[model samples]
Target: MIIDLTTRKVKRVVKLPKTPFGITFDGESLICCCSGKDIQMISCTDFSCTNIPKTLMSQYSYIAIQGDKIVCTVPDDSKVSCLDNGKLVWEFKNESVLKKPGGITIDDKGNVFVVGMDSKNSLMISPDGKQYKQIQTKEYGLTEPSTIYFDKIRKQLLITNINSFAHLYDVSFY
Candidate 1:
């Protein structure tokens, strides 16, 4: 559902074939990670939806936009992938370590950050998708972390988890 923040009213409601988990805006469209092996692209202007196929993933959890590319987390497969208008570009497979790849956010520099639902750790991949790094660990005290977002205003990385409080990581470190 789309809402008008200033008016505090619902502006539009979109129907989908399956549950929409992760959502991101690519300037002109609302990209929804659909439950059943698909991503829905909805045009902001007309609210028209187009479903794109995801043959590699059984389920989708989170998604992020890095410029014109779409980075999505496939929890069931414990993998992350980059797509160009629905075409595969590059992918990272981590089924051995990452159980359920969950929340994902991309920094302005295009670094991709993703969390694991059961692993209690976050992974960071280079903007070009060549370098992979494990970021958050138990020492950071994250418990079942869920989502992450880069606060452009404050220039920090905001993380939320099962815990009541949210954690803000200084962006400078990365």
Candidate 2:
């Protein structure tokens, strides 16, 4: 459903193919990760849908886009994958660090932030998918964090748990 922010009213509803799990705009089209390994690109103007070839067996639960790079988290498989122009670039999987990875967001520099529902933590992964550092943990009152967003303009990170708690943090990358 599309809403007009100024009037705060429903504008138009565009029907999707399958149940949309994760969605992001790539400056041109709305890239949607649907259930059952279906990734589609819906036109912003006409709302025409085009299917993006799937490369993984696992379903995507969360997604973020930066330029031609698309990142998604597969909670069922406990993995995160990056695709460039619909081609698999890198896949990160470290159950010890991120178990059941759920929500995902990408920074201007392409750094990926993800939350683990099972691990009850959040971490930042390098653009190359090599290194990762824990940014939030259970000690920070994160209980089953499932969603995350990075505000590029404000340089803040927002994380929300499955329950009722939400956290905002000032993030700086040096």
Candidate 3:
């Protein structure tokens, strides 16, 4: 559903072939992670869709795009994968660090931020998928964080748990 923020009214609704789990926009199209291991690119103007061939067996829970780079979180596999121009570039998996990773967002520098539903924490991973840091933990009141977003303009991180609580933080990269 497309809404008019100024009027708070629904403008239009575009239907899809499958249930959408995660979605991101890359200037022109809406890249969606759908059910049954499907990825689709839907035209923003016409709402027509083109399927992006599946690269992994696991179901994708969330996705984010930056230029030619596409990143997705696979909760069932407890992993996050990056694709460049539809080719697998890197996959990161560390059960101890990120268990059942969910909602994801990327920064301008290509750094990926994801939430671990099982681990009850949020982590920041390097662009190359080599290094990671647990930026938020259960002690920080993160109980089953489900979604995350990075505000590029304001340089803030927003994280939401499974319930009603939402946390916002001032984030900066050096």
Worst 10 residues of 2 by lDDT: 51-60
Pairs of residues at least 3 apart in sequence or in different chains that clash in candidate 1: none
> How big is the positional error of residue 35 in model 1, measured in Å on the Cα after superposition?
1.1
Ranking by TM-score: 2, 3, 1
Q: Please report the TM-score between candidate 1 and the true structure.
A: 0.90
lDDT of 3 by residue, 32-83 (tens): 8876756778887887878777543255479999998999988988999998
User: Who wins the lDDT comparison?
Assistant: 3
Clashes of each: 0, 0, 0
Q: Give the poorly placed runs of model 2, Cα more than 4 Å off.
A: 55-60
**Per-candidate TM vs. native?**
0.90, 0.93, 0.92
- Please give the distance, in angstroms, between residue 24's alpha carbon in candidate 2 and its true position after superposition: 1.4
Per-prediction CA RMSD (Å): 2.0, 1.6, 1.7
Per-residue lDDT over 1-174 for candidate 2, one digit per residue giving the tens place of the 0 to 100 score: 767899999877878766787788878888877777567788878877878776432564888999888899988989999998779899999999899998899988889999999999998999999889999999999987989999989999999988878999999765
Give me candidate 2's TM-score against the actual structure.
Answer: 0.93
Task: Predict model 3's lDDT versus the native.
Answer: 0.87
lDDT of each: 0.80, 0.86, 0.87
Error of 1 at 172 (Å): 1.0
